[model samples]
Target: MAWQTYDPTIEDAYRKQLIVDDRMCFVEVIDTAGQEEYATLRDQWVREGQGFILVYSIASRATFERLEVFRQAMLKVKRQKPVFMLVGNKRDKQYEREVSTAEGAAKAREFNCQFLETSAKTSENVEHLFKTLVRLLRATKQQEQGVQGPIRSPEKEKKGRKCIIM
Candidate 1:
């Protein structure tokens, strides 16, 4: 959901809650436009923002170019790889489009992050962008368990669903 506020936020804040994944997803919605003075604040959020949605305006090529710098900074501060989604917003302004969908997709590929086009004014693909990131994080966490399912007695093991015999 989009929010408008007269109350200024200095640190690029976050609001999180439990979602369908049954996980408390800590997502950072970044806006680098007026953040030139918030470098220290950005670093703090980067350390805590386990997942990120790197948003750029399709209407502005400058925003698109700056996206990579923000992403690299996030990776450096976290000292590890992170879950990220690259979003090209303002798809409704087709006439003003400065960045092509293919360009966004290609940049996402370079960073190995998911990408989608969205229109905040029209609410297109916006929810999908957020949902995809949640699932990606949940799936990554589940991978550690796939290699070792819970052990069960051989006598109770089903034929096709072979149990991990202890």
Candidate 2:
């Protein structure tokens, strides 16, 4: 929000505590911007991540086109269909938009994930995006638990991991 223009991020980490659906969630965000330099390490990040957010600027078709590359990488590393949320950013720049909302929604449908457009400048849907993702993560976790038959004790609880975005 403080940047005057798009800054090419190498990697940035953020920690936030959010209350979603009456449950407290501690979310850690790792923003890599999908730079080529970090391609070698992407697999590790994907393996440690529980949820994913794929973001692209609506004003840049090039950015949108690269979403598949990232999506493929995630699928390959996870070896299963992982949770995903597709975000078309820079909604504030409608005049400069190169990607339409329909295209974004279509892409989300193809990926079988939720989709939304957001303007970081105005803070639109920013919180909603994360809250929705957390809901998805929680639901997935609960489903897995139901399949496992019973909830384990705290002493047997598995370690936690971060929620990553690219």
Candidate 3:
């Protein structure tokens, strides 16, 4: 489940079309600069234990940098609920690339998240990106369920903590 800006004028209509065609669900559209609003949406999804993929243009260094701050906020708010992947979109723009593939991959690795270069324009690996996220989420859910027997509750798990921040 990936969420992008909800602008019906931009990609929203196309996203809705994809939903109608049974391509996706749980789509989120956000303002490009609305970090607060985006944070709220992300927190909500995280609380529901939903995973997400964050997309950025490899041609835009600023967007790439913003991903780090977003990741930090997610860690601060949701703690450990939702997992994420960092995607380098518009990979077909190799001739005009501003960020190298290795750099993108390194950033993802630093954040302990999956990384992939894709070109939505060319429809290159777009399907695979979403499919991989779904598969990983399912597998993670299964693993969590398998390990849920006789685990300590959140309260009990935090008993020894000297300081609690939420």
Candidate 4:
């Protein structure tokens, strides 16, 4: 489903193939929309999820405040620091915004994740949001596989010839 036209129910699942960083990435998106009735089901999905996007509407302060609940649940279920992206949605509703961008950034800092404000309606920053999350997920996967950037010996460092595998 296209981002702009997607109308999520209590839970909706979508699969899309994206060419992120020149690599084919199969992305499965499970959107719960933070409905309280689906908390148990959301936990199950959380356990199986490799990365998470905790989203709140900039127009709704209540939604923004509830982000911690979602974050804590992800941490509790994942049992490790989870890869996350904090998103303030409905950027097209700037006039109705109750949560400031600074608040979103601060909350992302608290969660130790990347922050972005996007408008699904206008397609503002929507692509960047997903792309950034994919990049972060890719980095996290590389780290887990013990592929941490370029390894340079002292001699190589002095020679200024470091090999980086992108």
Which candidate number maximizes lDDT? 2
Which segments of model 2 are wrong by more than 4 Å?
1-8, 150-152, 156-166
Model 3 clash pairs are 3-28, 4-29, 5-29, 5-30, 6-29
Cα lDDT of model 1 by residue, 1-166, tens digit? 4533323344344343325455444444654343768788778767755567788889999999998788778788986567888889889899999999999999999989889998867778865766677787657545634756634455643332211000
Per-residue accuracy of model 2 over 1-166 as CA lDDT, tens digit each: 2322344456877787778878776788778878878777778878878789999999999999999999998899986568999999999999999999999999999999999998867777888988899989878878988989656665555444334544
- Best TM-score among the predictions, by candidate number: 2
Worst 10 residues of 2 by lDDT: 1-10
Q: Estimate each model's TM-score.
A: 0.72, 0.87, 0.66, 0.83
Candidates, ranked, lDDT: 2, 4, 1, 3
Better of 3 and 4 by lDDT: 4
Poorest lDDT segment (10 consecutive residues) of candidate 1: 157-166
Q: Which is superior by TM-score, 1 or 2?
A: 2
Give the candidates in order of TM-score, highest first: 2, 4, 1, 3
User: Each candidate's root-mean-square deviation in Å?
Assistant: 9.4, 3.1, 9.0, 8.5
Better of 2 and 3 by TM-score: 2
Local distance difference test scores for all models: 0.68, 0.82, 0.61, 0.77
The TM-score between candidate 2 and the true structure equals 0.87
Better structure of 2 and 4 per TM-score? 2
| lDDT value, residue 96 of candidate 2 | 100
Q: Cα lDDT for residue 101, model 2? A: 96
